[model samples]
Target: MKVLMVEDDLALGDALGRVLQGRGFEVTRCADGVEALAMFRRRRPDVVLLDLSLPGMDGMEVLRLMRDGGSQVPVLVVTARSAVQDRVLGLNEGADDYLTKPFDIEELAARLKALVRRSHGAPELRCALLRVDEPTGAVFRGATPLDVSTRELALLKALLARPGQAVGKEDLHHAVFGDEPVGADAIEVLVHRLRKRIQGSGAQLVTLRGVGYLLIDEAMTEGPVAV
Candidate 1:
């Protein structure tokens, strides 16, 4: 599962990121509320860990905007606000769970995992005009369906799983080919094929030198290789 953790505290963010990564969760950190909200829309993370006290905008406002914008992604409020009213307000505003600062790392991780599962497991993966219906292995461009081979569909699924973020070639290979043997540059071939399929999808394919590839709306991009 992917997590968007919005915390301005550098030390806490780094430590939690490391712990979550150890549990096989991909994590991205955002320091300020404004950036965090933008990234949330771009990344479509499985869960959000938000600090109530934030710069640019408060986390509460971010939560409000997300709900107002029709975002169904789960959010967990993690802040130092331990008062009863603070917890009540966060829940009322749409936080899936609340965790106070100086919390037990293990409990936090467990709660996050539960929230991920409670949010209906894997979310409906959609980015711009590209949408993947996991149940049917169907790919769509708006209301229309696109013809795609199994390999092509798998490649797109992996790429769009984490929209606007670079997905490594090795990860793509595993996602697409599994344990099957494949020649070098196999992933690039698949990427090229899929690129043609998604042309004019409102999102474009981007290569980050040696890092990997990501699909993003050129207009929505704030920077290269970042949502």
Candidate 2:
């Protein structure tokens, strides 16, 4: 995947660019927000890693401008600010994901993969006769279309993307809520709604005791059942 990384710190920027390149990603590094925005429009990268502090324009302003200009490219905000308010503000401004500084490279890669996966919009997730579009937020059971909210659609996409894997609650939380603080039962509520909407669609939503939720189609795979 191609990525644009905007960071004022030259050393860190070089290190990150190298790391991502090592992982088979084409990276373009920019030292300021203005350059970052320009490169973004010029390259149209698959993902953007934006730093909060920049030389010319601030990261928040850049994000606002991108959204105002109708740029829906997935953005992952990387900043030193660990405060909840800072993260919240970034999310509100249009960041798809937020990671504080001093983070593990592995986690960063995972988040990037998730973001890119969502952006590319996986073909079709089939569980029995049901099918879903990971990109356009379209859901279908056989030939019928089901109405679903954006949040519910995102939740379903996150679940369907993993197939049989058990997606942890925290990961799902981040995918759906971004930086917002949601209650423990929030996932349950959303799952309930999804289940209702997908009724008779040959797909099932199951809970894994203390782990998290899983969406399964009986025809897809037979494994250890968690309910």
Candidate 3:
């Protein structure tokens, strides 16, 4: 999944980014709330890791604006503020989960997974005809079984969850490769192979020139080209 981490502390940001990336997340790190807001609008990450004490526009303000603008993406507030009122305020402002500083990265990952799962309105990992049991890394397409690697399943799950949206190449890269940057050709190769596998399954995977790929359901194929 893709995450936008809004943190002012460079050291902490780098550490969290590296750790989260290692744990299978596409992370975009922003040092301040303003930049976070801009990136959030552009990318619309699956989840947002926001810090309450941001420079210039505070994280609370950013969350308020995001809600006001009708963006319902899940947000997890990671901050040093541990007060009850502080946590209450952050929740009231639209954060799905809160994590205090010095938190375990594993716990953060688990919380994020829950938030993302809830945001997608699915009790489990499912998208249209595809269903994935994350714990066992099992996958099924409709009633037909398909054997897919863990990384490929991750890619498919991400794409299927946001069907019809043109997921950017960088975001996909982050989702699969995380901390390690992989070549664009690698992404292309994976998508190409995935397309070939799903070609006759009534799903259309279209490549947007100069942009990214879109996984479209058969019903949405006639809509405008995704970009």
lDDT scores in order = 0.82, 0.81, 0.78
Candidate 1 lowest-lDDT run of ten: 218-227
Model 2 is weakest, by summed lDDT over 10 consecutive residues, at 129-138
- Which residue segments of model 3 deviate by more than 4 Å? 124-227
Q: Rank the candidates by TM-score, best first.
A: 2, 3, 1
Q: Candidate 3, residues 84-198: lDDT per residue as tens digits? A: 9999999999888888888866557756876777777765655456666643346677777778765676577667657557888887876666556567588888887777666
120-156 per-residue lDDT for model 2 (tens digits):
8754566766677543346898889889886786688
Cα lDDT of model 1 by residue, 66-134, tens digit? 999998888889999999999999999998888888886645765676577668865667778888765
> On a 0 to 1 TM-score scale, where does candidate 3 land against the true structure?
0.55
Whose TM-score is higher: candidate 1's or candidate 2's? 2
The model with the greatest lDDT is: 1
- Using all chains and alpha carbons, the TM-scores for the candidates as numbered come to 0.54, 0.57, 0.55
Enumerate residue pairs that collide in model 3: none
